[model samples]
Target: MTTPHPTHLRIHQLAGLKPGPKLLVTGAVHGNETAGVAGIERVLKQFDAGELTLLCGTLTMIPIVNPLAHRLQRREGERNLNRNLRPAPIPQDFEDRIANQLCPWLAHADVLLDLHSFNNPGPAFAMMGPRDNDSDLEPFRHEKAEAALAACVGTGRIVEGWLSTYALGLQRRAARQGDGSRQASLVQDPHYGVGTTEYMRSQGGYCITLECGQHVDPQGPEVAYKAILRTLTLLGMIAPGAVELADPNRPIEVLQLYEVIDREHADDQFAREWASFDEVSEGQLIGTRHDGKPVHAPSGGRIVFPNNKAQPGQEWFYLARPSDRKLKP
Candidate 1:
């Protein structure tokens, strides 16, 4: 591996005597989410103290992926780093430079675990890639492996259709305009939905974006820590008894995101404060439009990723319905 730029990312690679799958774990892709950072540091400390050892393969950890945003303790130093995460031919922004360094690492991995924390209150859940599909943009052929990995992360809830739904949202936005005008903003980009896990999947690797918990939750770091250990054990990088796995028979709830609501007006307000996974009836009033028109739930389901700070044309929230997909044993 090449030495990274001093200010870009700090990567720690641990190799075992035997060759096995290369696993990459990343944290702090968003500056405000430090649970993954704390968890990764804890694991590194264990390794440094000779308390933990990699039995096989390589373990690469990037505890802080976005250093500038992390230093300022903001979501982004320039723009959201997670959106449109690909190496730039001619780097222009702070995150583009980061992506140039990060994308190579992602492409080299056999597996990826991206740790994150949400703003709105919700249970920890894993965001999964689509099932084996022939979609040229983000073809996913390892759904079973990905599902098993997500199941082992101790998150009882799993959600899918992230890139698919985002793509649909972009299409809707373009159709609403009818004109062929394309904006230069991040959200308006065709590749805006290509985030970390999506990029990993595109590289033919199984990946999971584990949302440990709320940003300020005291137990978020511990959740992330346990998830890291469990993933290491699951991938055979560590011994089985190194960390306790969740019950094999534990029921896992799967949700499929079908709709992404983009903020039409800057002043669009929710009917009340809403959190992720909050259930709503079909006729329930979710919020009010810019013109005082009511926005109600289109169907009976739960809300996901409700961003109260979204700007106009940005994704404000998503609607998800129960999925019948089962995790592989």
Candidate 2:
């Protein structure tokens, strides 16, 4: 809070009349995802304009977490700020400096909403922290709590297992013929593990990342705005009756990100223009590899986060499967 105006890690706070849970909402970890930034700005303005009242908790908003990258209109500045959130002995880059400053806030908050957007056109979805099997953690340890928090975000579609999916992708890449050296180099890349929301969960706090549709979609900001309101109500930070929550009986689609397809060869290309959430049949043609080999869907599932412009050796898309789980909260 002592940081001067225009600091990259800008923070705004509102204290309630009574002490309660501390909530931190962060936006633009990736600089190009500006909807969350705009949404957080609007939320703060509402607080200042007396349109929204804080009842019993602290609300802190960091509208732009990675200001330098955001200013550059890129996904990152020197590096992807989302990954490797652990403390560094010395700040190495722009994101590192930002992380060192922001991690404390993440550690102290009872709840966190890390806002983001996808590169491909897609409906809004919420990404929750890893479950027991998702990480090396004990079985079923964080699943219930993480699912509960994710459900409150009202995205209707909740995803888990991002870390697991990324790990599997790396493993597959490591198995490619004559690619061992490249695999070793890629594994050493800092953006390989838990991101912001997952890091918060590691600290015993609940966090959810809201992907508010495509980067440039106008609805993306509206999705983020409603998500924040819903989360505030669910956490009792805002009056329950003041804001409408999602219908309890409303159908919710739960998914586990199972596989991440990589564009391992330069000539790899998607078979067609595929948007996120597009369902594909088993054995359906998803794309083609550099060797003129066809890549078919291994199973019938919905494809999420499909990126036509993915670089070779990077994730081009992910396949998600349906889950029958219900949240207790």
Candidate 3:
């Protein structure tokens, strides 16, 4: 048998004459979400046509992070490329090999714009990191800067508390096991919550995952394109006023994720067709558990990422409440 070769990522880099913060933009971390790829291509086309110029700093764009998955038009090749996105010592899986190359680039950047699209119907939003904290799992000191950058991304909604809440869910799951021992599985790994943005935060860079819209939504690509231009202008990589930014007076809604519900069985089902951002009342019937028990909402909040096809032991949905955190101007 012949030895297999590792896959490499296609990266586009442009450097300006002046020095500034290094900005990294990535697309299609989940291969099926091609909006980012389309948006990045549009920007590249402008560069080729001499319509856009980088005034300062370095701009690195990886139009497709998971080439194998993208080629197949699937969410992943071996596993979800977005999860556990850190350089691995062994580089075992297909994603691990990709991470080995991706992580160094992440660490070298001053900021990152990870573009993605959701599976459900909802307005585009930005997923940001928590406020500056010393947490060992996912620590960062760029909340204000992240928020400012996010505001210019044309999204009115910002959601935080992803890694921290996932860590909390893992703790609860371990507690339920009653053996005080955690399983040695990908989902159970303490750092399982570490994704592209989380890894960037750990490297001291401001980052945001902009969920453009539904995967197949035609407007998803436009949102991604506008976000890219806005980010370039906001970060001074391009001239100020080079592109239109989000309305300064637009009301920004911040949400903090608090709960992640895992599918306990293959037969678990949602009560109805619930969409992301659908408000759930306290004690409302959210779904039916595998054991024929009703799973009610623990509190009044909005449902996020409601996955009807999640496998057993996978995250089925998440709950979030409005956050009072103030954003910087």
Candidate 4:
């Protein structure tokens, strides 16, 4: 077996007002999208400079989760680190070890904010967990979540898939338990299921993802600043006066997006001039086949994560979000 790369996990403790809720804020899970790095850095500075107070809980931040990727300025390591987490019997990679450690830590938190960014030039938004475990009747919980998201990063669009995937992972783990205690208990442990969010949820922690904005946009820094303020307010970690929104959050549509996987050989190549969230027309050329051929989209709206570096039988899956514009046809 090959040895995994060593990834050092750094922790920053923001000595809040005595004992308080713990919040885990991570950014740059993907090396290429680094808007969160700036946001996190700024937050740490503010906390240190006495600009923001940790009203109730701990604020822990990991600015860059993918250190190697950041160093390489690429999305994934040569090893597809993102897919190496969980259910692997043995985590045979550096990423897995980090996940194993991080998952457990995440479960202990009162709340978690997984900071991320897209490769596209678009508005920012938030992604929530699929299960509405918090009482549905509470307007503040749901509205606060939506408003927090809308206020932050400013993109009103919300994604339903990541949370759903997390919940499903949890449910699967629960169903596989032979013992009643282990079975029922794991789901409550926060790190029971498959995802970072699943682990957070099992630990009874409220977790959400903040996708800042366009990877290379300089404006991304400013956007992330806004998001951090809104998140702090929405979580009730700060006073309402601490967060003064420039304007009311805009209306955003909830999207049920889907993915298209790619299965191609290494030698066979396709051009990837397409950008993430780039609009696509039906039957438009998407890429080339593994055997040096072209592949076209049978159904399309947006082309997400278009890439030529994808491995064979691995997800070259492209995400498609329904267009906001009215259909011409």
Which candidate's lDDT is highest? Answer: 1
Weakest 10 consecutive residues, lDDT, candidate 3?
175-184
Residue-pair clashes per candidate: 0, 0, 0, 11
User: What local lDDT does model 4 show for residue 263?
Assistant: 44
Superposition TM-score, candidate 2 onto the true structure: 0.88
Off by over 4 Å in 1: 1-6, 176-184
Per-residue lDDT tens digits for candidate 4, residues 39-81, read 8888888878988877876777888776767767877554444
Candidate no. 3 TM-score:
0.94
lDDT of each: 0.88, 0.79, 0.88, 0.60
lDDT tens digits by residue: candidate 2, 1-329: 33222355678988898999899999999999999998888888887898888999899899889888887788877677787776667876667788888888888888888999988877888887665563353123567666766777677788877876787776776676544553345344544565787677777787788999999999998888888888888878877764567776777788888898888777898899999889999999999898899999888888998888776766788998886566663
Candidate 4: where is the Cα deviation over 4 Å? 1-7, 18-21, 87-91, 131-153, 163-195, 241-249, 267-272, 281-283, 291-300, 321-329
Model 1 pairs whose backbones collide? none
Candidate 1: tens digits of C-alpha lDDT, residues 1-329: 53233364789999889999899999999999999999999999999998898999999999999888888786876778899999999987788999999999999999999999999987799999998888776787898989989999998899998998999998876655423432335677878888899889878898999998999988989989999999999888988887789898888889999999998888889998999999988989999888998899999999998998987777899999999888874
RMSD of each: 3.7, 4.1, 2.8, 8.2
Per-residue lDDT over 1-329 for candidate 3, one digit per residue giving the tens place of the 0 to 100 score: 53343367899999888999899999989989999999999999999898999998999999999887887787877787787788889877888999998999999999999999989998999998888788777667887889898888988899989987898878765544432322226667677788899888888888999999999999999999999999999888887765777897899999999999988789999999999999999999999997889999999989999999886666899999999888874
